[model samples]
Target: MAERASDVVPSSAATSHSDRGRMNIGQVLDVLRPDFGGITIPKIRFLEDKGLIKPERTPAGYRKFSVADVERLRYILRMQRDHYLPLKVIGEHLEAIDRGLEPPPIEAVVPTVPTVALNSDGLPSAESFARRSDVRLSRRELIKIAEISEELLAQLEQFGLISPRPGTGHYDTDALVIAQTARELADFGFEPRHLRAFKTAADREVGLVEQVVAPLKRGRDSAAQGRVADAVSEIAALSVRLHATLVKNGLHGA
Candidate 1:
């Protein structure tokens, strides 16, 4: 597809800018090579063929890429490498940008870690850990982002290590974390079945916390609800720290 005439600067104007600002195909390669080691001239041409980018052409037909074109290529490469997005999806993003609309959010494809502050001892603070994330991922997205196979995800669901939201059928941030962690554990020969004990322990801790918070919830007052939230965060952090310490001591003794 041909680029819009307005998209290309006139040849007369091109010569007026500093030579460093405008780049030929080889110069574009040199600029992008440090960050994208695999980029090649043919790759750039392929993107043009797909109509994802359109560098201007000189009278002799040599491709003349503007700085904007180079940045557009960078965005395309980053989406492909970091998010595993296909060319079709990247094209949609570029179209959105061209139309002056915000690109669709990618949180579903790349779940963001919740912002959390740490304590003086380098452990996450209670309030920080309590911050809820609204990120929701489809089953396929979860598998791709976590780099796990369908079989592993099914096994995780079977063993109760990760699950979708109750009704929406979308996995949340917690599920994403569990899935990624399970994938890493598989490297050490740990299977989903072996993680059942962890689920059981977590349930026990949750139950204990619920018992303490139940009274505050019963009050149903705004102040009571606030207290309940604070209590849960504090208790959860303490429980995690205690669990970690016990495991460390046991490993040292062994």
Candidate 2:
């Protein structure tokens, strides 16, 4: 027999009314339906079945959802609707949160280069270069979004031009940018092998920046750390501008 919504008790005599801020299945729907019009009891139950959520059960088998549970459901739904992330990926994010580790970044549904990366002059500023993006993409997602073939991605990985986050098996915004740039360069008959030089040059530039900031970073004060960050950002931005200007002149001379 199908269980009616009324069968679930929000607060029974056995369960203290003030025991906790718990909501029955019907109330849960009311709270979530505003944002998730399509959310149904079965859908919530399905999530529970998938181990994405765990709501307490009353002695009579009524489901009781807590505030935290509702928030978790909201997050899961938003990730699905906004980013098209798979349940497995969402589960991984929840697991990371539970373990007190930072989860992989969630890219905006419509992917684009971050506006913060550019200044009014149409060049990257120190703040832009210093700002870290919070975009993460799975292998397949990166390939499709970057419009690159699997073989090409493998080549990029081999050349160390792009890589996934250390332990997350997900690509960050830097990887996405590199992939897109490589694809565009491929039009000029440039392969990943040719890009290795750029990677080498980038590493050298990074080493220079690190040397400049090493002394500032040694200071234990917060102000010292702030200065270190500012120095790295400013120097990195300048290095990029210099590299771009040199390349432009070289191209014109060639």
Candidate 3:
């Protein structure tokens, strides 16, 4: 379900700065940070590290927050509060919005995959058929897609299945793909203990498949999406028919 915009838009503690030049950055952060769990100066640096906030540097290279920066901070807060999103997801969400695209639904965009049980002819079960054919994920995103408990992620990492990179809890896209693969392997009697290359292979594989989904990931309005989906469906159907002819006949042979 889509959250109401108000539920996700950060509220301003801004005193309506008519003079954007003089707002003390720390004062603004303090007023806004408390709502986000007593956030401190370190949190600001962390958010900066995550690239969610970009403050101006003074002549001496000190950070300075303008009105715009404050709003961006508020946006960061809203993402964490309303979406329970990791920094990477939230950062990209804000970036797309700033670039004039609709933010992709956080839950709808999990990074995965494996072959489910094969049916008679070396194909996945009907319930797990093609999976849009190119679902990709990392170890971290696999957990997110599965909606598994965080404790499970921690356990996987404790076994070195994946690492929470640096200071951010956000998993790399590679982690998501690997995790999904690991889950599938686990079903076939492989465990995190068995796959040394799961993590690295996932990172590499996800990039290869992600190129296909990149176009779909571009955000759009409903009407625009409907048009694109219709076109894609039509093209896909035509391609399938074209495949039948090529497979069975001598039209335009190679």
Candidate 4:
């Protein structure tokens, strides 16, 4: 979500800035850094480019942000981090806020995946379907809930079966499911060593898709990158279906 204009000036930035109800972008960063750990200059600039925020420009051509700007950014960041909502949906939410209407709760934006069903071909709906804001668990939390020891987790990480989100030191729900499944497999005498085949197959599939999208991703434009992402996603979903079909065929001696 991009930052939106607001009338109420947050008190924190108001007292700090000596200028006319505005703080330079640096000060705004400092004020927001506590809540937004990954906030960067480029991200702020992108938000401005997206028309999420319209900071006042100084005569010296410096960007100056008001107290409302800070609060608006905070709101935008929270909506993104907590809800994983697409920017369009969040933009609508912000528009509601601008109109003095109470926006729907963030949960309203989450797509509810049905728990059970199979198509005529016996394929799952939305294979490999994990929502963007799926469960985020820390290392310790995952270890405890998945009933896996630290040693097993270390092996899983070593084998690339599971790893934390880059720089976040946390695993998503998919990692949790993988860990639990690995533990169940271990009960049947399967070790992490046996899982290397699965990992290798996954890496090969990923490489194939990366090859297809590499050229599309070369462009720096958002639309081009979006196309690359969409291609990767479609390929991943198909890969899941392929794997499931192959396993079913093997079990049926086809």
Candidate 5:
């Protein structure tokens, strides 16, 4: 895939403005290195892709950062590290700052996203499991808690990996799980572009599940939907185990 324009940042300009000191991407990283260890060009670009900072462009199309820009980056990194706030919340804070208002405190109103739990018999219960599995997170909360870049989140959504509920604009626990998994993969240098295959495979798997369960769901009886739920849960668990086994075998073969 072609790299996005946001990823190919421009080189810094030679001259600085009289009012504010200007630095290129490298210089900006130097200033932030002490505070944000292991910071990289990609991460900075990711921030820019998320609209966290708006650096000026020189005539050569290089990115030029002012002192304020560096401080803004610091504030965003600090909020994420210190308060576990999501990027959406940080963006709001930045917006408030732009409006000349004090940003709200970092106390998160939404708790961290929850994990799914299986029942005693090693099977997902019809009622309790479905109830517990239903996790609704606002778009901002999903991005913040998942610690994923909005760009990556958008890609995931585009590929149907992390889908928000229809009409509600809120994501469920499955989306959270997918986002969390994607974030972990990103730490190992796997960008969203590389993860499209996983999404495609999952869609295929879901299609297979739907083939079997669609009939059960079509029934008007309440028990029919319950049966469909149970079927999906079983297939979900089996699919996870199968995927893990296949990956393990592939790695060993490699």
Candidate 6:
């Protein structure tokens, strides 16, 4: 008996969809790395650690990604680049979408242009407040926060990895956070250079927080500003507490 041609070869539409429907790990990285300015291996692993992208495993335990994964990654990268967001916030935004919840209002993309050298004054032209004086350094003098040098910090700043104040020659508290994050990364042989995708993530997170704060920003009254500040504080505290509780439950519960 002769074999049927349809059984032997897939239709063009079928082949097209096969290309679109799913991808393997390498393929996903190939598609996404360019979007991330060629992210490093450790950075991809970091995303995995944060539960941002989960790939299925084959019988041989190879990871496999789908086209939908690519879309999600695109959105994730978009949020990071345009919004000045952190990964946790980006993950939360994505989580709400995955749960069939409406995405919060779409926001305009902001810039990641590096800040200029901060003068002694430490205030941005737009912001009237002083550089946050509340930053508590553990030491009185320059400390070994990391092996990060002034030049490396400059590069990070140039990529907007760490934002700065206008007047303070030194970086703001967030720079310290990045330095600490860099320290952890160095243990894995990842450098300040390797993880700049975090700047993209940070840009995305800022938008999320801005959207959350937008309604509160509508009025100019002192009362309104206080309410906004208090609300932000409460939300931040609750977010941390909730994460801790959920992890504790996961560890202790059946």
**Top lDDT hit:** 2
- For all candidates in order, the CA lDDT equals 0.77, 0.78, 0.58, 0.73, 0.71, 0.55
lDDT of 5 by residue, 1-254 (tens): 21111222222322233144678899887777876897888988999999999999999999988767777787787778767778998887676455333454455433443335655654444444346444467788788878888898998887667787888887877788789989999889987778888777878988988898888888988798778888887777677667777988999999
Model 3: ten consecutive residues of lowest lDDT: 126-135
| lDDT of model 1 at position 239 | 87
Greater lDDT among 2 and 5 belongs to 2
Instruction: Report the poorest 10 consecutive residues by lDDT, candidate 4.
Output: 109-118
**Residue 28 shift from truth in candidate 5, angstroms:** 59
Clashes of each: 0, 0, 10, 1, 1, 17
lDDT of 4: 0.73
Which residue pairs show collisions in model 4? 3-52
* Cα lDDT for residue 228, candidate 3: 47
**What's the best-to-worst order under lDDT?**
2, 1, 4, 5, 3, 6
Q: Lowest summed lDDT over 10 consecutive residues: which window, candidate 6? A: 1-10
Candidate scoring better on TM-score of 1 and 6: 1
What candidate 4 gets wrong by more than 4 Å, as runs, is 1-130, 219-222
- Residue range 1-254, candidate 1, lDDT tens digits: 21221333333333333255668888777777887899999999999999998999889998888867877887888788877789988886677456433355564433233333578886667976688766566787689878999999999999988889898887877788889989999999999999999999999999999998898889856788788889999999998889888998999999
RMSD (CA, Å), candidate 5 to true, equals 18.5
CA-only RMSD, every prediction: 12.5, 9.2, 13.7, 13.4, 18.5, 22.4
Q: Can you write out model 2's per-residue Cα lDDT over 101-171, one digit (the tens) per residue?
A: 34455643323333335766666899887787765677877898789999999999999999999989988
TM-score of each: 0.56, 0.64, 0.38, 0.49, 0.48, 0.37
Better of 2 and 3 by lDDT: 2
